[model samples]
Target: MSKIKIVTDSIANLTDEEIKVYDVHIVNLNVLVDGVSYIDSDEKIAKETFYQVLKEAKELPKTSQPSIGTFLDVYDSFEDGTEIISIHVASSLSGTASAAQQAGDLSKNHVTVIDSEFADRGQAYQVIEAAKLAQAGASKEEILEKIKDVKEKTTLYISVFSLDNLVRGGRVSRAKGLLSNLLNVKVIFEFKDGVLTPMQKGRGSKSIQKFLDEQVYPKLETLTVKECSLSYVCLTEFLHEQIDKLKSMFQEQVLHIGFTVPTVCIHTGEGAFAMMYYHD
Candidate 1:
């Protein structure tokens, strides 16, 4: 009968309402633009402005993972006898999970840190699943097992229209990204075990969607997707129309669509859309 707490980083693109509804605690990731660093404040820097700054700014905007101290501070705030399960972004992409683990090691109480191997909505899906299982009175071990099962069946489908952001974000070598672009080959990046790895290359959006439909959708079937949650994170609101088309195709599935946070958009730039579906 121990109380359990859920934690995650801001890059998960979790809405404030969702955080409250799920009773999840979020650690803010630092955003730096033009040598100015600040915590992500929804009330202050809007997602659009954050993305705009990245697009227009002279220098590349950078991101920092929450420190071990930040995690320790949050761990200290929990009530006595509380258990914590912190689900974080992919360890390959960010050091936030490692920082959380380091903090957990310092805590006297029970704390389980999870490396989601994905970012943005993909990470959010894992957090949501963990929250549901924890609220159902599942033990830390049981919840972690469930998270692993769900993560294995999860799918990340992304399409990048431009390589500028990828190069700036250090996702791809500048020469390679530029050469691929010159060949009219758009790349599909997959988040696996916490890194943005290339899955396939397509000629255009239609080809990318077809690749997901053919290559990625089958994986979701292996996990029995009836209890799954599907999320869409786009760099710009203009991509909503495309999302609607995908939603229509899977009309029976419950889908959650939202714009990616400033932290993500800074790296993705415009005309980037990613879909993360968790099943099992």
Candidate 2:
């Protein structure tokens, strides 16, 4: 039997405990803040510190995908004849998946690259599920099939409180951002079909929560939730309150929470919160 290994990039928002438990190999992305670059690792920038710096910085940070060489290095670390599964963020959002494929072509070992079509904890769900299958003596093909199923069944919903980061990152126009801020608009987005599409906009958290209650909760109630996770740009009283509400709602399910990665924070801004889940 061939040994199998799992690989994912930092944009997955995997925790240290999850990484250690799953033995997942992580390739750190690069974040440049005011022209200073830092590797996106828990030991290096830490999630909280990244958000703190982001809040204080005058310029928005830029993210770069791992290079082909980085992927090759990770591939070479495994023994010969090992089968590696490399999962990454959406190709529409980043080129990391394409770079991993290029490295796999050059590697001597058999490598399968999967574009997860998700980011943050949405991508993390696919990686963790794949790792679970790999540990259970499943073949590479079986694990790949499991990933495809998870991708289809998974859903991600995010709420952004401010558009400052989006405007700074050139994702939103400054004029529209200002208008949104003036009106206290909160935007809700859904990650589906490999893209982040706006679902609705509300004037405050109450209205946003109302949207989720009306649109999100009903859908979740119909499925058997296997796993769920939350990622936030910065922890706030409102976030804590929301988490409590989620815990009460998902009493029978497990929920994980952690700070969002710098790459994601660059677009959502501070006070952004997202919920990602995989269901049967």
Candidate 3:
């Protein structure tokens, strides 16, 4: 019945208040613009300013996972022998998860490091569930079982209204990306086994939202929403507003609405929205 700690990186896209409420340990990721590097969720730079720099930059910003020293600091602060679970974004997409695992190995205490195989709310959602289970006196084995059960239920849906950002971010081929932009091919993307894969393509922003509402949500709704949370991590207020409306319709259930941070927004583009749900 002893307490177990939960740790995750900022790329999980969890908000400050949520982290505080869950008593979670958060490691910050670094976002470099031009030559200067800033922590992804630093309080010094408001999210709007961070996004402005990202939007207007002549060159795309570079991101780096938290250094081993940063992880060491977090690991050393907690009591020794405590069972710490550090979860992070997919290793395929970023080195954060791998770095965390390395840090865990160096930890003097017992650490359960997870690759998460997810990002944004998908990763954050698992941390939230694990924290709750740990708080309820669940053993580490029980908590990890819960994490694995929910991992499969965790889904990420990203809508990209502009391929320009993807091209700039090197996520797509310049020629094909530009052509897709010229063709007005708004992409509906989803994460499959930690890879960003396009699920559907449409002509405009409205069509993309329709795809989310009509096709995406319907399929996701079939899964149980027990203790599930929803999040809106995007570049535009309009996209947040749209998800807010969708969240309102499901008010009968308890769900946390998480905001996207610069860490996630940088890759997803300027007019993108992502919805994450967990059936755990």
> What lDDT would each prediction earn against the true structure?
0.75, 0.86, 0.75
Where does candidate 2 have its weakest 10-residue lDDT segment?
245-254
Q: For candidate 3, what's the RMSD?
A: 2.5
Evaluate residue 172 in candidate 1 and report its C-alpha lDDT on the 0 to 100 scale. Answer: 78
Clashing pairs in 3: none
Best by lDDT: 2
Candidate 1 lDDT over residue span 32-101, tens digit each: 8788887865545576456557667788778899899999989878886778999988877678999999
Over the stretch 1-280, how does candidate 2's per-residue lDDT look in tens digits? 3289999999998888889999899999898888888888745567876778887777778889899999999999999999999999998788899999999999989899999999998899889989988888898889999999989988998889998887877666799889989999998888886776778887888877787779877777787888777899899887887688768767644787778888888889888988888888
lDDT of 3 by residue, 145-256 (tens): 9889878877777777777767777777799688888888888888857787888886877677777678866866676665444444333666666657667656644565
Candidate of highest TM-score:
2
The RMSD (Cα, Å) of candidate 2 is 2.0
User: How many residue pairs of model 1 clash at the backbone?
Assistant: 1
The whole-model C-alpha lDDT of candidate 2 against the native structure comes to 0.86
lDDT of 2 at 47: 85
Q: Assess the local accuracy of residue 175 in candidate 2 as a C-alpha lDDT between 0 and 100.
A: 95
lDDT, candidate 1, at 44: 54
Compared with the true structure, the alpha-carbon lDDT of candidate 3 equals: 0.75
